[model samples]
Target: MKFGEISESEYNEFEKNHPLGIFLQTVNQYHVLNERNWDAKLVALRNDNNQIIAAAVLGSRKLHIGRLYEVTGGPVMNYNDQAVVKTFADEMAKFCRQHGGLILRWIPNLHQAKFDDHGNVLETMNQAAKNNLELAEFQYNEPQKVENGHYSKVALSYEFIKRLNGLNAATLEKSYSKDAQYSVKKAKEFGVTIRKIPYAELEEFHKYTTATAERRGFKDKPLDYYQKSFKAFKDDDKFLFAELDLKQYVILQENEVKTLADRRQQLVEKSEQHLSKHRAAQARELEDQIQHHKKRIVRANKLITRFGQKPVLAGSMFSVQPQEITYLFSFMNDEFRDFFGPYLIQDYMMKLAVERHIPQYNFYGVAGDFSGQDGVLRFKQSFIGNTYEVLGTYTRVVKPITYRFVRLLKRIIGH
Candidate 1:
């Protein structure tokens, strides 16, 4: 087998069809990181026929001591093959050492275990993959307990994924929880429409995403980061906005109010003519519905006054790849929570996944806390998917002396 840097085109071709391909391991990601001043390379190992079998997009930046090399989300290859795994590890170590790398870190896109929504382990997997990497001299970095709980710097260890294999539209819709189905229906009933937006509209997406990040206490990337990503990924990236037309919603509400009032009038007339208690009760129920619709109209008008006639209630970004469709970043206006726009966005993306024949829809990055206290997990659970705990980060020290020196210096400095 031959190991060395390969052209972007060559790497992309191999990665596009690989079973383990992910957007993070693509040339587009390399370009995205390269633009940020990271040294990025597309490296591949090929068999005697010069057919590429294993590949990785390695990115490195100079740390205080030496270069910190990382391969986020992969080196797209079969980890079960020990020969390929060992050879790839050896080559990567040599390459990192030659490039003055202190530590080489990677988070393979391989599942460690599968858990149900309630965090019950349904199946244990990837032990052999871990063992193979260990034999290849890569030290597994087990998830560490931090103040916030289990955390890993390599990548998100837990993900909620819906497997779409052999699922038709009927079965796919059946997979969702009742709440999810109701939310999607409510979104449509509220006149919430979802559409794919262009890169020029990313500023709008950034605005709501930033607000949501602030409200949720998580850091958000700058506008330029998303812009750069969009530029690089182009057609493979989807920026979706779920919008509501306030004028239309208000009109609908007004119509409903009138219809309810007309029905209430009929019931009241009937109650007066027959002195029927049931008719009186029905009239009262209709009156309550009329009042609710009137309130909705007033709220819609207020929203219209604040935002424009049409306002985006939710926005989400997705990474489309052959292997899966990943729901990446998303945010929604809390004030418009009743619109259920985010639910519609998820439904739209999942439908796209099914249409494209993608095998999985990944609702990426949950806190791995399934105690029903985690809001993110709860939201993802509504989609009826399993929790996947991936084998976390692994490291192979390319320069042990420099690594040790850097660790000692950091300790001395209380870093």
Candidate 2:
């Protein structure tokens, strides 16, 4: 097989149908990177028959020591085929060298590693890493640091493969954790609704996302970042939100509480007349429900008074892809988390994907440590699906001194 730079149209046509395809490997993504000041390219490997077997979209940046070329969630190839991986790596090294680049940095979309909670390696995820290092004559040195070797990259993606043929809200509910199921039901009962917002309404999504970042003590991308993302994906992208009508919810809860109170009174009268075991149990359950509704009424009243009659934007999700939808970024107004906004938004996205005939919905980017304590992991795992531990990132050093100097510079820059 030989490697060659392919046109954007050719690469995208191949990528659109590949099972391993992702937004990161799209020509649109290259455009986004280019806007971010990175030089981008689409390269492919062809078999002896001149058919493309693997492809990648790379973005390069000039550093003080040399140019750094990075490919995110690529090259789109079969990592299980060692020969293909090596051939691609050697070709990639030459490509970088030709471009005056010192290294090829990438996190391939290959699932080769699995690990236990304590970080014990269950499978040797070394072939791709070895291929990358050997092609550039670099060593996988100690601690897996950027200075020694590229640090191990881990991301948790919740992937659902089942066709949405027989799926509906209730059936999907059965797959969720009991708490999550209960939360979904409660959110519905409390009148939380999910809606798709057009590009013009993306500012609201950004508002909630930025608020979340501030609350969580993380840096947030500028509004232009989301604007570029929307443009990158074009019509394939969606910005959705779970919203609560605070005033309406308050009224609904008030009426529900009144109805439950009446039911509790009726049950009390029945207990007074019969006092049977079933009657007493019914009375107790009615009382519990009455209390629950009353509490809900109070909560709703508080929210209404605080946020007013407008629909409260509770949480938002940004999704993109042609056949498979991936939730690229999401955030909730943490104060409204009790309304289970995030849960409702996720379920809404799944239903939307299904309605669009998209076969899969991805909850992207969870740490692969699988320690059960990771809140993100736990939340995603609650929805019964597969967790893929993709082959982590690799760096092929094309120029040794330049690579070392770049690593040192990265350290100095606190990368």
Candidate 3:
């Protein structure tokens, strides 16, 4: 096999069709990182017939010492092949060394295990691929760090994914948890509409995401990152927003209030005439419903006064790849939590996936805490998906002396 740099078109063509292909391994992501001042290159290993067998987008950034090189999301290839793994690792190490890299970091898009929503191991997958990488001199970083709430900014070590095979829009809702179904129904009833927004509207998406990041104690990327991503990915990227029509919601609530009041009035009259406990109870329930609708109407009116007739309740960004549709980032207006806009967004995207014949729906990252206590895991579980634990980040030191010296310096300087 010959190892060398490949053109963007060649890398993209192979990546889009590879079984392990992910958006992170694509040319689009390379450009996204390259524009941010990272030295990004598309490298591939070609077989005797000159067919690309293994490919990766290597990104390097200058550090305090030498350079930190990364192969995020891939080097997409048949990981089960020991020869390919060894060759790729050797070539990557050589490439990194020549480029003055201290360490070469790689996060393969290979799953180590599959689990149920509650973290119960259902199956062990791709163990050979992991062994091959380890045998090739890549040191596996313990996944426990990510499971313990320390997440990597480069890539996710754990993910929540839903299989969409043999499922359509009509059958998809049946797969959701009862609560998720109820939320979707309620969001629809409240006139929450989901639609794809253009690149010009990313600021609106970023606004909510930034607010959510602050509220949830996480960092968010700048608006330019999203803009560049949209430009690079183009049609493959979707920026969806869930908006509530305040006027329609208010009208619906007002009508419901009147309807409930009329029912309560009739029940009251019947109770007076029959003097029955059942009729009295029915009237009480009707009265409660009427009051609830009235409160909803009042709240809707207040929202309209503040945010106008239509307001965005939630926003999410998704990536459409050949293998799956990924739910990458999302945010919601906390005040509109009752509207369940996030649920609606998920349902909409899942149906879109079904329509497009996408095989999987990736609910990107989760702290591998499947104890039902992790909020991210719990929320994703509602969509009825399995947990996938991938072999976490791996590091190969290209320049050991420099790496050790840098580490020592950093430790001494309290960096």
Best by lDDT: 1
Q: Model 1, range 1-415, lDDT digits (tens) per residue? A: 8899999999999999999999999999999999878999999999999999899999999987789899888889999999999999899989999988888998899999999877889999989999998998889887754334334545787899999998877777778999998999889898899999998899989998999888877678799889999999998999999999899999899999888888877776766567477777887788889889899988889988898899888899999999999999999888888999999999998998999899999999888887788887888899988999888899999898888888898899999
lDDT for model 2, please.
0.72
CA RMSD of each candidate after superposition: 1.7, 4.7, 2.1
The residue-by-residue lDDT of candidate 3 on 281-358, one tens digit each, is 888788888888888889889988898998989899999998899999999887888999999999998998999898
The sequence of per-residue lDDT tens digits that candidate 2 reaches over residues 173-262 is 786779778887888987888877777877877887788777765556677778887888787677777888887887887787788778
* Top candidate by TM-score: 1
- What would the C-alpha RMSD of candidate 1 be, to one decimal place? 1.7
Model 1, C-alpha of 382: deviation from truth (Å): 0.4
**lDDT, candidate 2, at 163:** 38
TM-score of each: 0.96, 0.81, 0.94
